[model samples]
Target: MDFYHRAGLILDALDNKKGSVKGLCMAEAKKGRKAGEGARFLKVVVEVLKYRPHIQHLLTATKLLAQEPTLFVPPSSTAAVASALKSGSAASANKALKTPRKHVKAAPSPLSLASVMVHDLLFAKRGLTLPKEHKVRKKLEKYQPALEKENEREKRRRKVATNEGLQIALPEKVASSLEGIGKGKKRAHDADRFAEEGAGSDGAPGEIRWMRVNTLRWTVEAAVEWLEKCGWEMFEDVQEMLAAAQSKPKVFALDAHIEPLLALPAAVSLPTISAYQDGRLLAQDKASCMPAWVLLMPALLDAEERAEAGLLYVDDEDEDEEKKAAGGDAKGKGKAKSKGIRVLDATAAPGNKTTMAAALVATEGINGRVVACERDQGRFKVLKDMLKRADAKNVQPMNVDFLSLKPDDAKLKNVTHLLVDPSCSGSGIPSRLDHLLPSAPEDEQLARIRALSNFQLAIVSHALRFSGAQRVVYSTCSIWEQEDEGVVMRVLAKKEFREAGWRLAPRDEVMPTWERRGRVEACGGDETIADSLVRCLPEDGTNGFFVACFVKDETAAPIAAPALPAAAAAADEGEEDAALEPLEDEDVTEDASAPAVSAQPVKKGGKAAKKAKSTASQAARKAKDEVLGLASAPAAAKESGDAEVKAPAKKGGEGGKKLSKKQMYLLKKEELKRKKEAAQE
Candidate 1:
């Protein structure tokens, strides 16, 4: 930057030079004034006293510093080198020095513009240039004529050639744009949707929808009142909205994304109002509702199975009594309430299924049990937080994998219900992606998928081993057959694991349901693994999902445990036990080669043991059913003085001082009512 810096730079550059060097005269430096080099200035002022004491020291120090790129003189200083033959980026900058004008001037030259452009390196590699202003405008305009000509030619070409797709009667100019293609695709998706929606001759969206929001956060009364305040005409009936929203878009209720999860048509009703915004209501998708609803329905299990569980059954012991009573229905007084309905969501992180089950379990005075698990520690933290926010004490979190758990893990050992949502590739949904997965080499991804599936099967297999489990519901986000039906098939084909007792939940007349599209029939009432699996298509709903519920029959003789460890095998051999068997041949797939899980960690071990032992006292678990059945009150406009209740209360805290346990439960019930009211509003 200064005299010493310049002198030092010259020497450094010379040192960089590997060949013979030439003269660097002060007169020559002055000759190159346009170059702005201080080399000449130093020569004129300082060089006047050549041979001054210790002058060479100054030159050497600067020269040594110049060896590093960090110490190089920047492009700004390079202007000084112009007379000698412009060097460095400054040479390019000098060329770009535009002819000074007051207004917009001509485009910059190719070589000069290269210095300033951010992507200049890319362009120079291809020997490309920035377009001149005229050229830019002209090139853009030129596309219209050429594309038009191409369109005309295409129209003539396709007029006679029939392709198996939508007939493109419109000319190329009209059909070749994105607008046209998007319209066509939307129409196609619509056609697919409509056919699925209107399947089996007759269907109504509202009839298909069974509204069940976990009123834990908002009272139904408050929810409804808030809805009425929002100005949409309220109806206690699903039929009204179905009849109207089907004919008119104005009647369309709920968010576009929410409808598919509901797997029903939009309602003339509204799910969002001030009431929805306050976190009291969520317009859950219909297809998403199926997994939880089926788990609640008792009829899904066989008649013998339900009766053995003490469900309402007209016994032969009551034949004479039944006749005396006229109708075989027991109405009123001594009706036995459902005794402890405990559900375990083995992979329940983020609690989507857990929350849904909590809602399903909600009823006046009914306290249901839900033991939720999340194997991954980090995700379990999220599950814990969600349960607290939802005020969902009915469900507890178990931080262990399903296989690591045994019958002892469940608070209710003989509880008939379990919900298993395994980790999976979200292949069933068609959400836009940054990049298509198939493009990558996929060795890692495929390997991961295999690993996850192996773990999922292990969980389901363990769940089936539990006593009196009427339903073993297995689900995944994956669309791959290998992960979906194929995995299920492997379980079904196990010699020790016959499909003896299982029926998937069917569509109920009063509740919303998913299309049971892929459940093919199995032999001898034996559900083929694929036949029992339900695949929820993304185009029909908010997510891609698979649900399969296995009903294990204790009445059937217990099959031998498949694949005993060598230690267990040796113990069995000593006694010649018939209850032990070799591993199923079909279970040995190339992808499922991971060694058996070694052992659960000590902390997970402690909680699971405490949890497993506590779960045994099933009768102690209470149900919120008294709170759940609060759907009795019809649509009612909130009283004017009611502070005009609106959307559900937003999450986090019980609003103010911490609530005592009893009060927290009631507050959640009130919130549920408010949520239902808000959805209407």
Candidate 2:
């Protein structure tokens, strides 16, 4: 009875818009509730919510609530009921609000309790959990035959043979037809349409249990051998695996596209397996694996090549030195600097992609660094635990927001690649039970997607700013076009991106063999850009997902510094003059005279390099105008000539005037300074 009582309270809270089913149950558990109480609440509550619509319809059709109103009336409402009968006035009923509980002759069962009882009566294998003599149970027993009849009618209407089929077979129109069931009140208690609860209930048909071998601790061969020892057989084709897995849960198949990933039946329980317990095998969805794989594919290929040629350890000292400079640990050799590959996982809490990247890096003795960033303190702790479990020693966990990080910061300056899997609307996650909850209003859902799109754009845009980044993979577990192709369109249209040579990596570099590309219309109808993007849905045997890769074009010529149009420039002359004001006069003079060519141009890449080039070019033109008496070149040409200024002195003088006596003296002094500097080197 206490169980039923607590369950009713949770359901009531859900109806009154207090919180989500899981959230409310967890809240209760935190308040000194019994262990496993929350789990029981979730299990019973989720099922009741899913079947409540049909159950309400059944009750109405059978007139069960009307015939047995006493059993359905709650104790709290008895005072009002008695007052209404006595005075036959709404005002008199309100006056009875303080009626004593013992004198009121209250009804034993509430509607919420009756509804849960009805669900168990019709659906549960062993009938109601209540005692046979319980008044609610005895009352429902009288309508058992009628309830059973309506249950069959429901199955007939949906053309399903078993009760389990109702889980996925319920039509949206059926729910819409029952609009009068819980009318008037807002359905604010419904779960987000996109929340994921992993695989459905036991023996769900056609559901695949996707798993990836964590190669950080062991090889794929070793994992397969261990599985064979545990009596699991490997099948070559996934279809064969699924077909045999229906009866034999010990069968598995290698995923064709993703090498280290495997497909098992949803019924297979790997949590108890030793390999899974220790984190050598992970239960990651096939869709979730795509982002890390796509981002690190090129690097993994290079690493494999080096391993095969026996060159992985050939220059240990040089590798360590590079790793130290890049702020990455080499071979778990402490925090010594090494020039190893570096990857940043922008929203890495839960560590799926973070550990995946680490494992991929370890596959061929590729010494690499992975910096996993998570802002939420609670989730950051989870990320640290996951990294430790996965034996991801190369990973450096940061409890800070990735958006707040400066790409030029010393620790992240040499990050060669990034994985931006930021928070999304979760609209694409396939849930086992969340659909049972009522959906958010359409306008509210759209507003949420808009907010999420802005966030996704901001995080990915930030990732592109990394100075040493060559490729950035922006991924989300969202199916919305706005968050997917729409974001890519906006990012590609950014002025900084175009000027920095950031473009979509070719399809060949992405998951080219995965047949589904992005929505063409979503990418503004450009087929090539759409083809470069990746999209996944549950129908593809994975959660709904999207991935887009942005790669820098190293071979592309440097962009000339940007110049405002003459008309626009004149219109904002005041603002431009203000912007040109020097922070410190001496600093400005030194910067203007200093060479614009960076000792390592690649280290100061992206927008930073471009801004420096533009500033230096403007200053050089100013010096030429003031000292040599040459007229300033047009804005476009003057900015364009910045790249040319890096040439030798002969090239600098080719089309310009010869050095004056004062300039000759300065040049001689600079030559002597350079000679001395070289001597010191």
Best by lDDT: 2
Candidate 1 ranges with C-alpha deviation above 4 Å? 1-212, 217-225, 233-272, 299-338, 409-414, 432-438, 442-448, 499-514, 519-531, 556-681
**Worst ten in a row by lDDT for model 1:** 582-591
Model 2, position 279: C-alpha lDDT score:
81
lDDT of 2 by residue, 404-481 (tens): 566667866778889987766555654423466667688655555554555455567668868888999998777888
Worst 10 residues of 2 by lDDT: 584-593
* Candidate 1: C-alpha lDDT: 0.41
lDDT for model 2, please. Answer: 0.64
The digit string of per-residue lDDT tens for model 1 on 1-681 reads 233333443333223321111112222233344333322232222221222112222223334223322222233233323322344566554553542323322222221121122111111133213344634324323333543344345446657332211121323321221121113335433222222221110112322332334477766566555545655444433455556655544322332212212222343223233333343554444555556656765532343365566654332234346446857564552254334466778667556567778865654323466888766554566568667756787787887655455454345574568887664554543321202111324754454445455445545665765665777777765566555654565455444345344333333311333345343422222343344456776455334667666666646654432333332233223211111111111111101111122221122257776575344221111222111111111111132111111222333756633322222333343334444555534
